[model samples]
Target: MAATESLPVTGGRRLYVQLGITLVVLVAAGGMLAAHRATLDSGTDRLAAADGEWLLLACLAAVATWVCAAVAQQGAVAERLPAGRLVAAQFAACAANHLLPAGAGATVVNLRFLTRCGLSVRRSATALAVKAAVGGVVRCVLGVALLLASPGTVRLPARVPPALLVLVPVAVAAVVLAVALSARLRRAVGRGFADVREVHRSRARACALWGGSVAFALLHAGVVVAVVHALGLGLPTGRVVMAYLVASGAAALLPTPGGLGSLDAVLALALTAAGAPGPEAVSAVLGYRLLTGWLPMAPGLLVLALLSRRSAL
Candidate 1:
């Protein structure tokens, strides 16, 4: 009886600790964002004069990104989930994703959400792996297609640093080393792959997974494009889309909370390299971040808290 009583208390303490750490990270990220706002505000006058219609469309695209993400998440699972709850969970997960590097926070939230919806922990994890893998492959496909269509837009700089060349292989090695070190983890991965095979056997599941992932990526690009249009930056739409894909792919190679500063800087540079004016590109990136990251942050955090209180996490 005593041991059983202590279990809940211990778990509660652990939860508190996790939340506290997340809150601290959030605070730090906020500070970093504030410090970086100098670049963002460089074109505040232009930003203020942005076309409202295009800005509104960008906001809609942001909303669509979340919806598409929810669909992608749902498609990854075999069991039917409560639609409203699933979407809300994804909304909250987006906020959680920003609190940790490398999408770890969002992974945790979705893992818990999937289990709550009905699945063993292994199954839930497998579903997430499938979703991530599919999303990644689709993104790469889109990026490559765009690159081939407009090679000049995404052309590598004249000199590639030796470090940038080795980064990817090194990251792959690290992941392989981590997985190889744990027998239990290997088994989990094997099981996850098996689940992926099982889920893909269903045509509806497969289509939903691919379609939602594609839509999610496209909507994100749409947000950037809308922001550019709003700011009257006259870069080609194809180049902007290509820039977004390349920058996003590069940002994913590094683990940062919501790809905050790194993403903003890379994206803005990519836009300018593709021929957008510096101030206009900066303004567009700022608007995109506002629509996708900052504005939704507070409500998403609130939803996260609500979900946690209800044990939906």
Candidate 2:
């Protein structure tokens, strides 16, 4: 009886710890949101009159992107487990990402999920790294193509010129050189290439991954546009896209939790440079955060809750 009572107490203590950690993260994220919110007009009357259809579409697009992301994750882990299981693992990982400090928490959660599903830690780590690399490469390529194709749409500040174009090719060359220089990466690339060859697979998977990534990128950009539309702000689509890509790319490179403060700052600056009034741009960015960062977090938190309950049972 004492042991039974102690078990409940122990579990309760653990639950409290988890709740405390989650609350801390929420508080930190809220603080960042509040700081940005201060710069926004965020008038209740304006927010109330915002368009609904676009907001709904934005939510749909975000969900679609999440699904595509899960599919891509599954593809990367296909060799380790059934596709359905891998998809579930991906969703769980995404949920963890929302709750944890850095996005890396999602990767750790994913590795655990994969291990539970019978994959070795080493294999799971390798697969996750590959998936992340593929996703990042695809997004970067699409971002560059979009920026180049619609140069007029994506205006940089006067300080930034077309000469910045050199950075893209330079980045590509650097990556190729790095791959050649690193024996580990070279061997991995060689093995990956050989795997495709032996499986009679060409670049089909790569193409599909890139296509899906681009779709997600566009969908993410649409979220910002929808937010602006919802706020009744007449922002240019191209400018919005440019800001979204730049802010997103910078956030991806940052070590902060989900890029917290840095993303909002860059976005606000980008929008301002593109001729959006400061208050309006900040308002639009806040709305974008609500849709992209917070709304999904509710579902993610619920998923985490269910997982915890199952573990307790």
Candidate 3:
């Protein structure tokens, strides 16, 4: 009942978010044309001259992210949602993420979708939280796995810094102490543990949650790899993936919508650090954003608006 009641509110918010993004795009487009015309033209020419086959792979990988998102969302709960709508919702959510900060857009669209599909409000929110928690863990694990599987892929210090080693345990202890002392946080942690345990009870659900999340992260990184190859950038793929994971994690600290400017800047720096030339690194970042960010907007907007048209039950 609470879920049903909250649908209209979230749905309305999502509409506003999309509309706001449309306006920003229009304004940003004009600004870019006027302010960065030369750069735009350069990027356009570069994109035009890029390898078609690699670009196509990037596009496909970008689309595959939506499917993975849907799978993870489904795995977050025991209920079976309609596959088609789930994908559409994820598409719309991803689109919204580009406009709103801290995942506000995704929260709106997905929560509404879950409620519209009959999940209770609390369960819907919990599912989102659970998926997020699992996604973070999976990203770290994947990065470590890649490092171990591929020898000398990324350079790490042969020994941990003495000061850093001491600080790490202190930080962990501080966090645990805070959580243990805060009743609100304690309840939140309890709820998260309970939901995670429930998800683990179903073998398929656990696999989908972890596997889908890992695939989603890899596919997103694959876009960067494809774009690099498309532009004949000679950086190693393993290094690019590791750089992307690090840059993306850093970008999350900033509240930029879909990580627009923040991600571009950080990722470009990461690529450069990974041995890509500065200009080429920026170009690769532009190509990555073009595929992952801009390309999905049109379809996502249409899907969001269509979802908004339905009445709250």
Candidate 4:
């Protein structure tokens, strides 16, 4: 009787600890954003005086892309999920991703949610792996294609080291290969490929899902480009796309919450390599972060809170 009585108390304490940790992380991220505020504000002011219509369009594109991404994940798990439940699972997953470390905790949370919704862990894991691979491959292909199509726009300076260009492809390929070879990875992904027969039956749907995912990624890149343009910088579309892809890929590897310092550094470096002035590029990147990262996080937090309340009730 005593043990049962203490269980809720212990669980409540654990929840408090988790909340404390979350607060600390948010505080740190807030500090980092505050440090960059002046630069972000200046860039915002610059962009405000430029093409407002494009910025609005970019915002809409981002929202559409986010929904498309959720749909792609749904398609990956279609065998195990109903459409409405899949949409809720994805939104809940997104909300957790905004709150957790490396976005991985969200995956665990998503898996649990899927189980509650009647999906097996193995099936959910396979679907997630496929979604990640498809999204990554599409992003890289688009990035490289953009760079190739307009070499002059994305060209590194003659004085810049050749190693940087070599690094991009090598790094991407290595990451993909490593994932393919892992034992644990094989178990998760092998099943998805084994479902190749089923996939073939729905080949057109699969293709459409993959295409939508790619389009969604492109829309995200467009948002970054619009943010830069709003800052009164005239960047070539191809170059902006290339820079966004590279920076986004690199940012995924960052340890900081939501890629804090790491994303800004990579974006600035990529932009500089692509012919933008260093200060201007850094400013633009900071401004983009404001709109894409911090602004969205607030609403995500609200979603998370509402979900938690509903769960508790």
Q: How would you encode candidate 1's per-residue C-alpha lDDT over 74-159 as one tens digit per residue?
A: 88988898888788898888877776788897899899999987798978888899999998898899988887887876666799
TM-score of 4: 0.76
Backbone atom clashes (below 3 Å) for every candidate: 0, 0, 0, 1
Across residues 178-291, which tens digit of lDDT does each residue of candidate 4 receive?
Answer: 878898867655677865445446866587568767877888788888877776678777787888888878988776656667777998998888778887887778656656
The residue ranges of model 1 lying beyond 4 angstroms of the native Cα positions read 1-40, 156-189
* Candidate 2 Cα errors over 4 Å, as ranges: 1-45, 80-92, 99-102, 156-204, 308-313
Where is model 4 more than 4 Å wrong at Cα?
Answer: 1-44, 79-101, 151-153, 156-186, 195-200
lDDT of 3 by residue, 173-230 (tens): 9999999999999998898899999999999999999989999999999999999999
Per-candidate TM-score against the hidden true structure: 0.85, 0.73, 0.86, 0.76
Better of 1 and 2 by TM-score: 1
Pairs that collide in candidate 2 are: none
In terms of TM-score, which candidate is stronger, 3 or 4?
Answer: 3
User: On residues 251-272, what C-alpha lDDT tens digit does candidate 2 reach at each position?
Assistant: 7777766666678789888888
Ranking the candidates on TM-score from highest down gives 3, 1, 4, 2
